[model samples]
Target: MISETMESHKKDSPSDIKCGIITLSDSLKEKGNEGIEEDLSGQYLFERLSEKYEVSAYVLIADESDKLIQAISNMNSKGIDVIFTTGGTGLESRDITIETLVPRFDKVILGFGEEFRRKSFEKLGSGALLSRSTAGIYNKTIIFALPGSPNAVEMGLNLIYPEIGHLVKHARK
Candidate 1:
């Protein structure tokens, strides 16, 4: 069944897939308050995703839910196939990425979060439970909320990269 689905997607899966990388942070700034910082996690996402997809947009914003929503809305308008967000997935007061994005999802990819935590536990033991990394579909675009750590971003992407093309293809259909 899965193989048939992949076969069906091969014809419709976009070759020039466009992706967006969003870094959610309040403390990380570039100059004054107008720009963003280096955003290593976001940069990691850009590099890894660039190998397969065209990174159409990348931005940094605060942990505020409104700001996150605004950023996502803007990205969605740009016809982005996927959006990868790093940070604000913890238990801290400002860690609201999961809370902010989940409710807006048209379909939640529960397996992504479950598998992410399973992989995370192998590397970080019980500490993985504190991470709220997740993935879902909204407005025909796939969104992944990852932990702030660069390691988490890499791991999460590595696990999901294989399915992104198929997911995007099905969503658009």
Candidate 2:
């Protein structure tokens, strides 16, 4: 039933979606964009995403709300179809990505976080629950907040990449 229900909405759409990569890490932001060397997870996201989608913007910002808002605005200005934020979704006090972005979401994609945890749980045991990764529609763009670690980013990217274009089509409305 669910598969058929989902299949009903599976209409044809172009896949030339543009993307933006944002790294929310206070430590890396201290070095500015020059800190790209230390941003392994973000770099990985950029490289992988760039293969199928155009990476319009890649930025490193502190876990501050102002910085996050600004980055999203810049991405929106470029008409980015989706924004992927890595880091600041863990249990640390500086993990403000999800908290700062959630209130602004026009529609939260709840299944993203839930499924991410479920998938992570298989590999990480109970520690997977500590991740607060989330996804949503904001400013007509799809934003996915993922964890900071390289492994987590890899998993999150793999989980979402195939559906990104499909997800963007709905959010574009």
TM of each candidate vs. truth? 0.91, 0.93
Model 2 residue runs over 4 Å out of place are 1-11
Question: Whole-model lDDT, candidate 1?
Answer: 0.87
Scored by Cα lDDT, where does model 2 land?
0.89
The C-alpha stretches of model 1 lying farther than 4 A from their native spots are: 1-12, 30-37
Q: Write one digit per residue (lDDT tens) for candidate 2, span 62-138.
A: 88888999999889989999999998887777788988999999999999999999999999999887989999999
Give the TM-score comparing model 1 with the true structure, all chains together: 0.91
Clashes of each: 1, 0
Error of 1 at 122 (Å): 1.1
**Candidate 2 local Cα displacement, residue 105, angstroms:** 0.2
lDDT of 1 by residue, 1-173 (tens): 35875677676677778899888888784343344446789888998899988999988888899989998999999999899999999998988899999999999999999999999999999998887888889999999999889889999998988878877887787
Which ten residues in a row are the worst by lDDT in model 1?
Answer: 29-38
Question: Alpha carbon lDDT of residue 166, candidate 2?
Answer: 71
